[model samples]
Target: MHLNYLANIGRYIPEVILVLLMVGLIILEATYKEDEKNRKYIFIATLVGLVATLGALIANMSGKAEAIFSNSIIIDQFSTLIKMVMVLGTLAAIYLSRFSKDIYESLKTEFAIMAVGILIGGFLLASANNMLTFYLGIETLSILSYVMAALKKNDQRSSEAGLKYALYGGISAGLMLFGMSHIFGVLGTIQFAGVAKMIPTLTSAQLAILMPSFVLLFAGIGYKIASVPFHMWSPDVYEGSPTPVTTFFAIVPKLAGIAALIRITAVFFVVDSPMKIGWIGLLIVISALTMTVGNVTAIGQKSVKRMLAYSSISHAGIMLAGIVVINDVGIRSVVFYGITYLFMTLVAFYITSIVQDKYGNDHFDRFSGLIYRYPFMAVMMAVVMFSLTGLPPLAGFVAKYNIISSLINSKNYALAIVLGLNSVVSAYYYLKIVRLMTLKPQESNEEIEGFGFLNQMVIVSMTVPVFVLGIFWETIMNLAAGAKLFIQ
Candidate 1:
C-alpha cells in the first residue's frame, strides 16, 4: 500500500503541484492584507506556479498510458496535451488579469486563487478515468466560474451573469448526475473502461436506458462546451464578467470540456456499439445548429467581446465536427485545433481588454482608426481577426481545413457544408472588426495608448505562435497526431 501510494504520487506530480499551489494561494490570500503590492505578488506567484505546472506536465508526458490513483485518473499523451492547454490558458489568463480595471486590489488574490482552483479542476478533468472524478472536476470548475463571473460586485450585469450561469449550471449538473445514476443502474460501474467493456453485452432494454443516459450526460458536457441550445448563458456571461475571467472562460473550461467530451464519445460511441449511429446523428444536428447560430448572431453584435462570445460558440461547433469522425485522426485534429484556439482566443481577448481599458468600451466605433493611433496593435488585432476568419496562410485556416477534411473523410458531408458556409459567414463579422480598425477614420485626436511592456510581451508571445504555426503547420499536427485518446 505504501509503494502504491508513492507510485500514484510520482505519476501525479503535475496535479500535486497544482494542489499545493491552490492551497498556498488560499493561505496567502487569507494572511495578506488587501493591497496592490500583495495583489501583484499574488499575480506573479500565480504565473510562476502555472508555468511550473506546465513544465511538470510536459515532463510527465509519455507515449505509453498508465492508470493512476486506483484507475480514477489516466495519464497518457492525450491527457498530457489537454492539461498543457489548460495550463497555458491559465497562464495567459493570469497575466491578462493584471490589466483588468474591474479586478481591483481586493479581488486580485482571490482571482489568482480561483484561477488556480479552476486549473486544478482542468487537470483533473483531462485525466479523469472514472465518472465520479469527472463530475467532481466539472463541478469544481463550474462553481468557480460562477463566482468569477460575479466578481464585479458593483456591476448589475456581472451579478446577472453569475445568476444565469448558476441556474443553467445547476440544471446541467442535475441532468448529468441523474444520467450517471441511470448508467450505474444499468452497467454497475462508473469507470469509463468498465462501461466500455460492458457496452457490447447490453440488452435492448438496457441500451434504451443507456442511450438516454449518454444524451443526458451530454447535456452537461454540452453546456460546458457551449454547444447550441446549451450556449445561451455564454454570451451574457462573457460580456459581463471581468475581461480576464472572460478570457479564462473562453479557453480553460472549453479545453477541459472538449477533452472530457472526446473521452466520453470515444468510449461510448465506438464503431461496434449499437447506439453509435444514434449519438452521431444527434451530435450532427447539434453541431450544425451551434455553428449556424454562433456565426449568424455574431454579425449583429456591436461589442467586439460579445461578438467573440458568439464566435466561440461557432468554434465549439467546428471542433465538435472533428469528433463526429470518431477516428484517431479526427481526435488529433480536435486536439490541434484546441491548441491553436487557445493562442488565438487569448490574444483576441487580450486586445479587447486593452481596447476596453483605453476607450471605456469594446464597441466597434471604439476601434475606429486604431491603425493611426496604435499601428502595431492594429496589425496584431488584424492578424487575430484574419486568423479567426480562417483566411489562408493563418493557423485558423489550417485548423478549419483539418476539421473539415476529417469530416469529409468520414463522409459527414452535410456538417462539412454547414461548417464551410459558417466559415464564410463568419468572415464578414471578423473583417468588420478589422475594417473598423483600419479603414475607418479616427473620431478623436487623442492617441490610443498601447499596452505596457509586460502586457505587450504576453500578447506577442501568444500572437507569434498563431502566425508561425500557420506557416509551419506540420509541427503541431505531428504533436497532435500522437495525442490519440484510444488505441486500436
Candidate 2:
C-alpha cells in the first residue's frame, strides 16, 4: 500500500499545480491592478506553471508501470509520455494568453487557472485504472472544458456553442455513469482487471445485462474523442471559440481523449472472443468513416478552424486504428501517432493564429498572397499541411506508415485499405490550402502585417518536431516499442 501510494505521485503533481494556480488566481484577483498592456505577466506565470509541471513529470519517468489507491490509478511509460505531451501542448496554447481577447481584466489569470485544471483532468484520464477513476478524470476535464469553451461568455456565439456542448456533455456523462453502475452490478467490482477477469465466467444473462452498458460506456469515451456518429458539437465549438482556444481543442484535449480510449479498451476490455473482436470491428468502421468524412468535408470549408476541427476528427480515426489492434504494435503506433499529431496540428493552428493576427482573415481568399509577404511562414504552413496529408519525409507520414503496418501485421487489411484511401483523399484538400497560399495572388496587403512575434515563437517551437522526428523517426518508434502500457 505504501508503494502504491508512492507510485501515484506523478499523477498527483499536476493536480497540485492546479491547486497552486487556483491560489495564484485568487490572489491576483484581489491584488492585480488591471492594465491592459501588462498582459505579459499572464504569459510568464502560465509558462512557469507548465514548465514546472513538465519538470515534475520528467522526475517521475521510468520503464515500469505501478498502481496506487488500491490499483485504481496507474503510472507507467504510456501515461508518462502522454502527460509530458499534454503539459507541453497546454503550455504552447497558453503562451498566447497575453493576446487572448477574453482575458480583458482579472480574467487573464482565470483562463490560465482553468487551463491547469484541464491539464490535471487529462493527466488523470491517462492514468485511470478503473471506471470510477475514469469518470472522475473525465468529469474534471469536461467541467473545466465547458468553462474554457464558453470563456467568452459575452459572445452569443460562444454561449450558443457552450449550450450545445453542455447538453451533449451532460447526456454523455449520465449515460457513462449509468453504464458504470451496470458494469459494477454485474461484475461486483469497478477495478479494470477485476471486470476483465470475470468476463469469461459470466453467464449469458449476466453479459446481456452488461455488454450493452459496456457499449454505452464506449459511446461516452468516443464522444470525447470526437469520432464519427457522436462528433456533432466540435465544429460549432471550434468555429465559435477563439483560434488559440480552438488550437487547444485540436491538440491537447484530443490527446487526453485518446489516452482514455487506450486505457479503457486496450488495457481492460481486450480478449480473443468473437464478441470482443466485433467491438474491434466497430472501431474499424468508426475509424474509416470518421477519417473519410473529415477529409471529404474539409475540402468545402471556408473557415480554416472548422476545416482543422474536422481534420482532427479524421486523425482521431487514425489513432483509433492503433487502439483497435490491442497489441504491442498498436500501443507503440498510437503513441508515435500522437507525437506526430502534435507536430502536425500545433504547427497548422499556429499558422492559423499567425494568419488571423496579420490579415484579420480566416478565409482562404485572404491567404492568397501569404507566400509573397511571409515566405518562411507560408512554407512552414505548407509543410505542415503536407504532413497532415501524410506525404513522405514528414512525421505524419511516418505515423501513418506505423499505423498501417501495425494494422496489416494484425491482419486488419480491409481497414488498412480504408485508411490508405482516406490518406490519398485528404492530400487533395491539404494541398488546396497550399495552392491558395502560393499559387493564388494577393488582392491586398493583408498578410504583410501578420507578423505576430509571440505567434512566430510558438509556431517555430511547434514546427521543429515534424522535421526532427521525420529525420530520426526510428528513435521515437523504438521508444514507443520499448514502453509498453500493459505487457507487464
Candidate 3:
C-alpha cells in the first residue's frame, strides 16, 4: 500500500508542484505588502513555478497509464498534454496581466493565486475518471473564473460579468449534479470505467434515464465550451473582464472543458455502442447551430472583444464536430486544433490589449492606420486575422483542415459543410479589422503607447508559431495523435 502511494505521488509530481506553487503564492501574498516591487517579485515567482511545472510534466510523460486514488483520476498522455496547454496559457495570461493597463497592479499576487487555482482545477479536470472528481474540478475552475471575471472591481461591467457567470455556472453545476445522480442511480456506479462496464447491460428504461442524464451533464460541459444556447454569458464576460483574464477565458477553460467532455464521451459512447448514435446526432446539431450563430452574429458586433467572444464560440463548434467523430482521428484533430488555437487566440487578445492601452477602448476604429503607424505590428495582426480566417500556410488553416477532414471521415458531411461555410462567413469580420488597419486613416497623427520591447517579444513569440506551425505541422499532429485517451 505504501509503495502504491509513493508511486502515485511520483506519477503526479507536476500536479503536486502546481498545488505547492498555489500555496506558495498565497503565502507570499500574505507576507508582502501591496506594492510595485513586491508585485514584480510575485510575477517572477509565478513564472518560475509555471516553468517548473512544465518541466515536471514533460519528465513524467513516459509513464504507463494508471488510475490513482481508486480511479478518481488517471495520469496519462492525454492529461499531461492538456495540463501543459493549460500551464502555457496561464503563463501568457500572467505576463499579459503584469503589463495590462486595466488590471490593478496591487492585485498581482491575488491574481496569480487565482490563476494558479484555475490551473490546478484544469489539471484535475483533465485526469478525472469519476463523477465526484469531475464535479470538483469543474467547480474549482468555474468558481475561480467568477472571481477572475470580477477582478476589475471598479468596473460595473466586470461586476455584472461575474454575477452573470455565477448565475449561469450555478445552474449548470446543479444540472450536472442532477444528471450524475440519475446516472449513478441507473448504473449504480460513478466511475467512468464502471459506466462502460454496465452500458451493454442497460435496459430500455435505463437508457431513457441515461439520455436525459447525459443531456443534463452536457449542459455543464456546454456552458464551459460556450456552445450556442449556453454561450450568452461569454460575450458579456469576455468584454467586461480584464484583457488578460479575457484571454485566459478564451483559451484555457475551453481546452479543459473539452478535454473532460472527450474523456466522458469516449468512455460511454464508443464506435459500436448503441449509445453512440444518439450523442453523435445531438452533437452534430449542436455543432451546426453553434457555428452558424457564432459567425453570423460576429459580423455585426462593434466591440472587438465581443466579436472575438463570438469567434471563440465558432471555434468551439468546430472542435465539437471533432468530438462527435468518436475516434482517434477526431481526437488528434481536436488536440492539434487546440495547440494552434492557443497561439492565435493569445496573439489576437494581446493585440487587442495593446490597442485598448493606447486608445482606451477596443473598437475597430482604434486600429485605423495601424500599418502606417507600426508596420510590424500591423503585419502581425494581419497574419492573425488571415490565420483565423483559415487561409492557407497558416496554423489556423491547418487546424480547420484537420477538423473538417475528421468530420468528413466520420461521415458528418453536413456539419463539415457548415464548418466550411462558417469559415467563409468568419472571414468577413476578420478581414474587416484588417481593412480598417490598412485602409482607413487615423483620426489624428497622435502616437500610441504600449508595444514596448518585452511586449514586442511576446507578440513575436506567439506570432512566429502561427506561421511556423502552418508550414511544419507534422510535429504537433504527431504529438496530438500520440496523446490519445487511455480508454480508447
Top candidate (lDDT)? 3
What's the TM-score of every candidate structure?
0.96, 0.94, 0.97
lDDT (Cα, 0-100) at 342 in candidate 1: 91
| Model 2 ranges with Cα > 4 A deviation | 1-11, 34-37, 100-106, 359-361, 446-454, 485-488
In model 3, the number of clashes is 0
Sequence-dependent TM-score of model 2: 0.94
Candidate 2 colliding pairs, count = 1
Residue pairs clashing in model 1 are: none
Estimate, for each residue in 111-130, the C-alpha lDDT of model 2 and write its tens digit: 77788778878888988888
Q: For model 2, how big is the CA root-mean-square deviation?
A: 2.2
Instruction: Name the lDDT value of residue 346 in candidate 1.
Output: 90
Q: Which pairs clash in model 2?
A: 358-450
User: Across residues 366-425, which tens digit of lDDT does each residue of candidate 1 receive?
Assistant: 888889977778888899999998997989999899999989988889899999999999
Q: List the residue pairs that clash in candidate 3.
A: none
lDDT of 2: 0.79
lDDT of 3 by residue, 305-338 (tens): 9999999999999889888888788887888788
Model with the higher lDDT, candidate 1 or 2 = 1
